[model samples]
Target: MNKKLFLLLLTVCAFQFSFAQKNLLTDFPKGYTPEEVGKRLAYRFLEGKHMLHGGKWISYPETFNWNGALQFAAKTNDKELVKLLQDRFEPLFSTEKALLPIKNHVDLNMFGSLPLTLYQITKEKRYYELGMPYADTQWEVPEQAKPAQKDWSKKGYSWQTRLWIDDMYMITIVQTQAFKVTRELKYLDRAAKEMVLYLDELQRPNGLFYHAPDVPFYWGRGNGWMAAGMTELLRCLPKDHQDRPRIMQGYQTMMKSLKNYQMPGGMWNQLIDEKDYWAETSGSAMFTYAFITGVKHGWLDAKEYAPAARKAWMALVSYINDKGDVTEVCVGTNKKNDKQYYYDRPRHVGDYHGQAPYLWCTSALLEKDTK
Candidate 1:
C-alpha cells in the first residue's frame, strides 16, 4: 500500500473513534424510552421538595404540577409512582382545611383535580369526598368586593372570568377531571364554555393567543397553558358536543402558529414570536406534548408533525443533567407587555414548571410509541 494512502486512512479512523467517544449514544441518559426518562424525572421530583412556584406543597396552583405526575402514574399504573402520589396527599386527607389552603378561591379548587383522579384509581372515598366541594363551587358567581365589576375584585372568580390565557388550564383541567370522575355533563359544559369564551376573546389572527386581552405579549407558557388545557378537555369531551368543532379549530390553529415559532433547535423562545429571546424548556415540552396529541387524534399530520415532536423532545432532554434536573426553565411569570421583561425573567434548574412538562412529554411519547 502507498504510504500517503495508509496515513490518510489511519488519520480518518482516529478522528472517527474520537467522535464516537465524545457522543456515545449510551452516554445520553440510559433510557431515552419515554417511560424510563419519565420515571427518572418523577424520582427527581420525589427526592426534592415539591415546591415549584411557591413553598406550599399542598395548594391550588403548584399542586397542578404534582397532578401531572399523578396523571403519568395513572397512565402507567406503576405501583411505585402510585405510592408516591398517595404518600404526598394522604396526610392532607386528615382535614379538609389541610387539603384546601384557601376555602373559597376557585383557583385553589384545582388542587381537587388530583384527589378526584386518585379516587378513580384507588376507589378511596376520602379522595372523592375531598374533591366534591371544589368541583361544585368552581363556578358560583361571587359578589363583587366593592360592587365594581372588575375581574380581580371578585372572590371566587379571581381571574377566572377575565379570559386570561393562564386561566385556560388553571380552570378547565379541574372541571374536566370532575366530569371524568362523576360522569356529569355540567362540569364538562362549564369547562368547554369558559375555554371558548377565552379563545374568542384572546386568540389572535395568527392563531396564537395573547397572554391576556389587555396584554399583547405572546408569552410562551401562557400559550402552553392554553394548548395543554384544550388538549386535556378534548380528551374527555364528547365527540358530538356542540362546542367541539370550535374548540378543535382553535387547537389546530394554535398548533399551526406554534409550529411556525419553534426554533430550529426544537425549543421555543421565551417570548415565542421574538427571534432573539431564549429557547425555554417548559414551553418546548408543552408543544411537543401538544404535537404528539394532535398526531394521535388525527388533528395533525403525523408525517410532518411527528418529526417536529421528536426534535422538540430531543432538545428538551438535553436540558436534563446527570442528576435529572431540567434546566433552562423560565420561572413562573406574570403577564408583562415588555419584551425585555419576558427575556430577562430568571431561569432555574429543576424548576417544577420544567419538570412537570418533561414528564408530560415523555408520557405522551411513550403512549405514541406504543401505538
Candidate 2:
C-alpha cells in the first residue's frame, strides 16, 4: 500500500470500528427483531393495493419490495406469509395480466423477479415460464431497440444498458434469480460483465459512483442500488468466476467509502457526503444490508465492520414508525448536476423504495442456515 494511503485507511478504520465489546450483536430488544420487523413490514406491504406504474403496470419498487418480502418469508419459514404473497400474484396471470410490466426498460423488466421467487417457493412451471423472458429479453435486442441499444448487444451487453447507476440493481436481480433457478451461467455471466463495465465507467477514485456520465452527483439511493446489487451478485458469483475479482474489488472499495461516510448518528445522508442533509433511511438500510452480508460472508473484517453494520441496523429501526413505514426515506430520484436537486428530493414514508431494503436488512441480519 502507498504510505499516505495506508495511513488514511488506518485512521478511517479506527474511527469506524470503535463500539461495544460484548456479543457484538444480540437479540433485538423488542420490535426490532428481524422476525418482528420483517413480518411487520411484509404484512404492511400486503395491506396495500397493487402499486403500478402509470396505474397500469406493477411498479419496480413494489416488485423490489415483494422480492425482499419473499426472501424474508422463505428465510423465516413463514408459510402463511408466503401464501399471502402468492395469492397477491395470482391476479397477474388472469385479471391483471395487462398489469404485468413489459420487458422493455430495465425498471419494468425487473418485475420478473417476483414470479421467479414464486417459482422457487411453489415450483410451478408457469412461474418459471412467465419470469424467464424478462431476463432473456434484456440481452435479446428487440426490434424497438435504438441503434445504440443494438450496438450494446453486439458488444455483449444488454440492450437496456444506459450506464445508469440504478441499472446495476434493476438488471442484476432478475438475471440473478434466473441463474438461481436454472443454474445457468449465461444469465450470471451477462450480469457480471455488465457490472464490470459500470464499475469501470462510473466508480470514482474515492470508491463512490456518479449517477451517470453527464450527471456527476452522488445521489444516496443511486449508490444504494449499486451497493445492494453488487452484494447480491457477488454472493451468487462462483469463487473462480472470471469477473469475481473485479466485482469483489469494486464491492470492497465502495464499502470502505460507505464506512467512512457513515454518520455518527448511525445513518447516511441524501447526498452521502453532505453531512448536514437529512438522514435518508432507504440508503442507510441498503448500506446496512450490504455491511451485514459482507461481515457474515467474511468478505469484510468482522471486527472492523460488524459494529458499523450493527449500529446502522439499530439506527435504522429508530426511523421505522409504529405502522412499519420507515420515515425520512428519500423518494425515487433522478440524477442531476445541481447539488441542491439531490438535497431537495422529497422524503416519503412507506414508499416501496424504502420498504424493500428494510426487508433485505432483516433477511441479512437473520441469515444463519444459508451462506
Candidate 3:
C-alpha cells in the first residue's frame, strides 16, 4: 500500500481500538445485563477520582487510597496513576511504624496492604521489609486471643479487644502477601490460623459473617471486608492447603446470604438485613470486587454469583457524577454496635476509603468482561 493510504488505515484502527477499551463511566443501553452495566459504572466511578487526595498539582496522600491506586494501576496498567501514588506516599514510609497508631480498625489495618503493593511496583525489599514488622505485629497475636474468641477483653491491644470480621482481611490478607514475598511459613500459618479464628467466632447462623461479634450490629461494609479479605486470602494461599475448603465455604456462605439482601437498584443497604437502611455505595462496591474477583479466581460459581455482583456494580455506578467523581460513599467509621449508628452515618463524595473500592470494583469488572 502507498504511504498515505497505510497511515490513514493505521489511524482508523487506533481510533477503533481506543473506542473499544472499557473505562469507569461509559454509557450503555437500558436493561443491559447487570454485570455489564455494573462493570462500566464501577470503572466510571474510579476514573473520576484518579487524582484523589491531591490538589490540582500537589496532593496529600493516605495509605489506603494509595493502596487502592496500586491495585488499580496493576489491573488497568495506568502507570502515571501508580507513579503519582508512589511519589506522594513514599515519604510517609519514613514515619510508619510496624503497626499504625490509628485506633480505627480499617485505618490501622491499611498498613498490611500498602507495603506489598509498594514491593510489587518498586521491587524494593524495604517495602517488603517494612511490611515484616507489621506482619510480625499482626502474627504475634496469641492463639488464645484470636479475634474469633467471644471475649474481647482477653486481647492485649485496646483496638483488637473485640471480634470484628473486617479485621480478618485487614490483618490476615497482608500477612499472607508478606508470606508470599518472604516465603515464610509463619506468615502463612498465622494468616490461616487468624482466618479460621475469625470465621469460627464471627460466622452467623444465617451463613453471613457478622460485622462485629462483640457488638449487636451487622454492617454491610464489615461483611464486605470479610468477603474481600477471604477472596484475597484465597488468591494467595496454597491450592492444596487444608484450609482451602473451609475458606471456600466462608466465601460461599457470604455470597449466598448477601444475594437476598441486594436491593432492587443493585446495592446492599448499610444494615444488610434491614431494608430501611440506606443503600451504601462503599460496601456495595467492595462486594462487587469480592464476588467478581471470586468468579475470576474460580472460588465462586460464576453463573450464580456474577449477576448479583453485576447488580451491586450497577447500583454503585449510578453514584458517579459527570466529572468522574464518585459520590455517596459512606465515610470512615470505627465499629458501631447500634442500628441507629450505622443508619445515621453520613455519606460523602470521593472519600479515600471509597476510592479504594471504587478502583477495585472497576478493575475487577474490566478484567472479566470489557465492552
Candidate 4:
C-alpha cells in the first residue's frame, strides 16, 4: 500500500513540472525555434506579390528585403531560398525605368547595390553593369551628409552635418556594397567616416542616437536604420582601420542603451525610452539583429544579451500574421521635435519598412555564430 502511494505522488509531481516548463516557454512562439520562426517570416513575406511600398513593384527598401533573404541563403547555403530571391529580383532586369539614375539623390536608391550582389552570385553581367552608375555615385557626397561650414573639407572638421540617423544605412550600405565590388579603399573609408561623423552628432550620452540632432525623438525605425546600418558596415569595415574602434564604440554604446529600454514582451517602444509609447516590431527586429550579431562577434556579452535578444526575436515573430505581414510598424515619419508626434504616428501592417527589418532579423538570427 505504501509503495503504490509513493509512485502515484511522483507521477503527479512530474506532470506539474512539465506544465510549468511549458508556461515558461511561452516567451517564444510555439513550434518554432528562433531560426525557424525567422525563416518562416522571410518565406511568408516573399510569397506576397506586392511586398514593395506604394504598390510599386520594387523599390530601394524592398531590395533590402530581398538582400536579407539572399544573405540568409548565402549563410546557410540554402539553394532553394537563393533561387527564390533571384526569381523575385528577375522582374527588375525586365525594365530599367524603376532604377534611379545617378543624377538622383544617392539615398533614393539606397539598396542599388543589390544588383551588384546579384551579379556576383549569378555571374550575370547585366546585374553588375546596372549597378555601376549607382556605385560611381557613392563618390559624390550629398549636401545632406556634408558639413554646413564652407570650409567643411578643410583641416579641422566639425560634426555640424545635416545627416539624419537614417542616412547611416542609406549612404553606407550602398558604399559598402560598392567596396565589395571594386575593392576600393575609398568606399570603405567613406562608409566608416559617415558612421563616425553621425555618431559624433547624434549619439547621446545614454548610448542611443537621436532621430536627428534637431529632432531628438529617438523614433524607433530611425534608430533601426542606425543599428542595422552600423551592423552592416562593421561586417565589411577593415579591422585595422582607424575608424573601426570609434564605430565599434558607438555601436556598443547604442546596444547598451537599447538593452535598458527593451520591454518585457521583447519590443522597444515607438519612442524608445518612453514607457507609454506603443511597442514596435521594426525597431525591435533591428535591435535583435544587431545585438545577436554583436554577441556572435564578441562585441556583446552573450550571457547577458543573448537571452534578451532571443526574446525580442520571439516577440517579433508574434507580429507576423499567417500571411507573413509584420504588424505594429510605424509608417514613414518626418523629423519632428514633438514627442507626441512619434507616439501618435500611424502604424500599418505589411509595410516595406517592416518587411525589410524582419528579413534582416531573421537572417541575423539564422547565422551559425548566433547559435
Query: TM-score for model 4?
Result: 0.82
Better-scoring candidate (lDDT), 3 or 4: 4
| Best candidate according to TM-score | 2
How many backbone clashes can be found in candidate 2? 0
Q: Mind sharing the TM-score for model 2?
A: 0.93
- Model 4, 187-270: lDDT tens digits are 788778778888998889998878887897788888988998889888887789999999999998999889999998889999
Q: lDDT per residue, candidate 2, 264-297, as tens digits? A: 9899988888878989998889999999888778
Q: Report backbone clashes per prediction.
A: 0, 0, 5, 0
Error of 4 at 44 (Å): 3.1
TM-score of every candidate relative to the true structure = 0.85, 0.93, 0.75, 0.82
What do the candidate models score in CA lDDT, each in turn? 0.75, 0.89, 0.65, 0.74
Error of 3 at 213 (Å): 2.6
lDDT of 4: 0.74
Better of 1 and 2 by lDDT: 2
Show the colliding residue pairs in model 1.
Answer: none
Error of 4 at 58 (Å): 3.9
